[model samples]
Target: MTQQPEKEAIITVENLEYAYCDFKAVDGIGLTVKKGEVFSFLGPNGAGKSTVINALITLLSLQKGKATVAGYDVSRDPQKVRESIGIVFQEITLDRDMTVWEILEFHGKLYSMPRNERRIRIEELLDLVQLRNKRDIRTKYLSGGMKRRLEIARGLMTRLKVLFLDEPTIGLDPQTRMRMWDYIRKVNKEGTTIFLTTHYMDEADMLSDQISIIDNGRIIITGTNWQLKNTLGQDIIYLETSDNIAAIQLLRTLPSVKDATKKFRGILVSVHKDGTKVLPKIIERLRENGISIDTVNLKKPSMDDVFVYYTGKEIRDDPPGKNGTLTHRPGGS
Candidate 1:
């Protein structure tokens, strides 16, 4: 009957806010990331994800509230916070002319890593990323996946308590993204806390120890993937009927039906009881009301469903000035 102790927080934010001129990008938001976990920030583009990250990593000055990373205050000890984290940007940032080994080696030097230490870390990372054989190849010659691996490797050149991965696999193919996930898992197992922002729902579902979904400069929900999905109900039934609006309204009248939301082409119903039991009732009720059912799909809730249920829309590409990017230096200055 004993409660478990809370894990130590490696990153903490309290009523954090940031704005671009008069436009507020990050509203008063607060959350904590425990040590040694892959914590994902899931949001549509321009959802203030980039702004919050930029603040936590000390790229943007804190305009209000507080944030601490690796035990250093982002506002007061920005340099210390920077030194404790490594960043992999959404865009590929390697100098095409530089060799793989040189990219990592130069990053180590930038952080003032000692000569022997830099060499040792370089070898260790190249091996870790499976780029040992291509160590001497110029980055431009590498495939997209290879370039991503190199970027991850470069980020780890210095010893870090946390790694900030911004859209880490944005442009990679599915198979390569899976491979990158493996590398990321290995890194997390090795004890570095991973703070991830990603566009892929499957990516967040598969890799996150915890997830926070942000929208319009605010966090909509924060929980494990299962926790978030469970909020919708035991099962979800997607229905496309002759009268979608009336179908959703009648669905809400069922005692077993938890809630229903209208989708573009259908309505999604969440059931408190077994969907099989609820499904029959749903069809009969609609029939009584003269609503013809064209389609009915039953399944467990997914991350996509959870996102839509809460945000009322699908994730979209960020528009300019909503979540703008800056060229990231591998290790913070």
Candidate 2:
């Protein structure tokens, strides 16, 4: 007999669907996270990333198909799903008046873990997230970075098989965000399945083992970060200035410009798919237009570029659909 794996899949989603009033939020979505992979759901805002997360955790009722977290069905066995998952919501969930240690301890008791085990887990997690020194401080007094770190510690209090983080470092500084990535990597290395959603391209690129780009309540693409990167036809050139009309005119004459759109006072221009080979020409054309450049950035086509290419909108703009409250679980944003 072939020796099989012992621990079963930690999460399964199949043909899942959800709608708010007349509009669907998640459309026939499906995914499965193995025992220890860091799987990511990425999208423009309001693309139903929250909707799917909510369904998976059993916070929102499933409108179609099925999902199982650990071994329990999402619709029929929500409590079981809850038992196996720990969540760090987009909206901060820590009790502001409670000390960091106190919050983790309180959350641990809710999961019915033994006192000894909970203590050990909390200590270990605090160190893992680099928060051992700040454990006694009340959450409200902590800096945004510190509070985010404490939330990581709290999320691990339950010894969860699946960890869900939604936009984990939205407003953090670059250093803090990078440190958080390191901590998240540490968690996945300890054999927990990490699931997260982010609108930030860099965060998704740096950490996700595989990424699913969802738009308009449906997944537009799903693959490893490299896979998605490789799929893009060419690189992108981004230009920012204080003149929208001038910015558009600046890019209009560039033979390499495949597409150009005015964004506020600036214009984001896409080079021809094969135009990446002629990078110098792109710049010369801009200079000819006399568009005084405020900022010029070179970027490979990212998940965001891929989303905009298909949807014709920026990542932050909410899609046209029935609006609904986005709650990924009980203590969520």
Candidate 3:
């Protein structure tokens, strides 16, 4: 047997921490994002997702611990880290008065890109983001989606290895969000590592190759979507019956059933393999035991289900400004 080589980490953090006054915004969290991977930090508002990103990108000073981006130490080589990565903040930072072309051209110039090369790269990125037709239009005139696409284009102005997108599609419609996802996929396919943070479960589920669920300034869980869901281990069988307690005990003893528990008024069983195959036997056994089942359902776990399972609550977009700097309220995990 041969051991495979480990994938190189493009972004690495070790016990990273940041604080404001007495509040520890990012509490000793650490993660690694592999080269060309779409790594997402999924959490509610003010879960310290943004703070961690800020630290990684060298925007916020690291109060403690260490981080490296694109092989450059964040603290020692902030400029190198900045040059190696691009950032799209939660707030739009585009110049509304400038044309899309002008904005990109300016960014390219700021990076000291040669004129001819800048022109060619701008054209390529404009087409890549599907905004060639809107290139001459002022940014203020472009729709939210177009502006976002332009921001993405601008982020790619430099030859970057990593791109950080903070809540990239928070306000877009479903169609537009899908379009953004397509663009993001295309970028990732072309080999730019994407590091994004979003509270949207579906967005994380669809876009991320690796996901870390952060809550109340701490990482509650981290894994691929399937890996995270598989931690629950087996499909959930829900039964609303005449006697929940008796049904739980009976279901738990079955070889095909992994575990069974009482959920509210229903008996929730974790079925070992094919839930459909086990359903008939469950029903038969319950009937034989004189247990009357009123309703039955077998469900595969979703990322949202997994999120609630780990964090003990669903993701919520708490309004900004209500709680000063940190907006998310701490919940049981």
Candidate 4:
């Protein structure tokens, strides 16, 4: 018998593009999300991550290239795309006046879910998000984390095949953030493909099976966490076993060495590039100085280093509030 070809990816975009005013928001970007995989679209602010997701959600038109989700053209069949996907945005959208149970019931009814099924769905979601205890409490009384869990549970009301979680744990406490991560994993295990965007490097490092690093509307890198980090924050150690000290002066001439600081018995070498690859030659130089090696250390940069390498900026450097007011940026990290 002939072998059957593998199925098409769950989502595909060909030269997909969009712009805002004079600044291009999404510049000929291309990506694919596989069935049942957690694919992350990661980038710093002003990098067009939000704009691309908005286009997929049908809030913006597809001005160039084609985008298809679950075999439905995003532009031509928006309703079908919407039905097949669930979205949990960065912003929390809920009425403070209503209790948790009311909002979930109302959300189900909006989709024309049958009364009996709506009840079953509500019970399941409440338990799924661990909110059964808060079902009757006003949403306003819940903490930041609780509200986020509610949003996740509410998204499941539609029984979606794909989930878009945009910075799902943005401003919650560390403990709360971990809780949200658990909830995300639980949902994924139940058979949902997820498209996640996040600024928390640690979260992205731990969660995404595959990640695309986007910068200023273009994808600059794509790989699993280990592979990608290897490209950026490489381990490089500074060494100077030379007591001759004159030889250390010659080592400073190398362009890759950023700064060489003299410590008690050795030097702490920082590099603009990987120093491990330069280790052998460095050892030879020390031997020429009649120096013998006693110690060497290797230190790799963190995910923060990877981010700066791509965008040339730090995520936390951005002003956290608008008009210098907290009210304008509630729950924003």
TM-score of each: 0.89, 0.74, 0.79, 0.74
Which digits, one per residue and each the tens of the lDDT, describe model 3 over residues 129-239?
788998889999987667777776787677679999887776666776787788788878889999998767789899999999887788989999999878765687878
Best by lDDT: 1
> Taking the tens digit of each residue's C-alpha lDDT, what string does model 4 give over 1-333?
999776458888888878777789889899888787788887877778888888888888898988888779999999999878888877789899899999999888877889999999899888867889999999999987788778767876766688898877765667767866886777788888889988878888878888898977899888888777676435545454746265457567766665454544566455666667766666776677677878887677566556655555556522221111111111112
The local distance difference test score of model 1 is 0.86
Quote the lDDT for 29 in model 2.
88
Which regions of candidate 4 fall more than 4 Å away from where they truly are?
1-7, 112-117, 128-130, 233-298, 317-333
Cα RMSD (Å) per model?
6.3, 7.3, 4.6, 7.3
Question: Candidate 2 versus the native: TM-score?
Answer: 0.74
Mind giving the per-residue lDDT tens digits that candidate 2 earns over 75-169? 89888889888898877788899998999999999989999999999988887667888889899998776776777667767657889988777
- Global lDDT of each candidate: 0.86, 0.75, 0.82, 0.75
Worst lDDT 10-window in candidate 1 = 324-333
Worst 10 residues of 3 by lDDT: 321-330
lDDT of residue 140 for candidate 4: 95
Give the clash count for each candidate. Answer: 0, 0, 0, 0
Residue ranges of candidate 2 with Cα displaced over 4 Å: 1-10, 128-134, 238-276, 280-299, 315-333
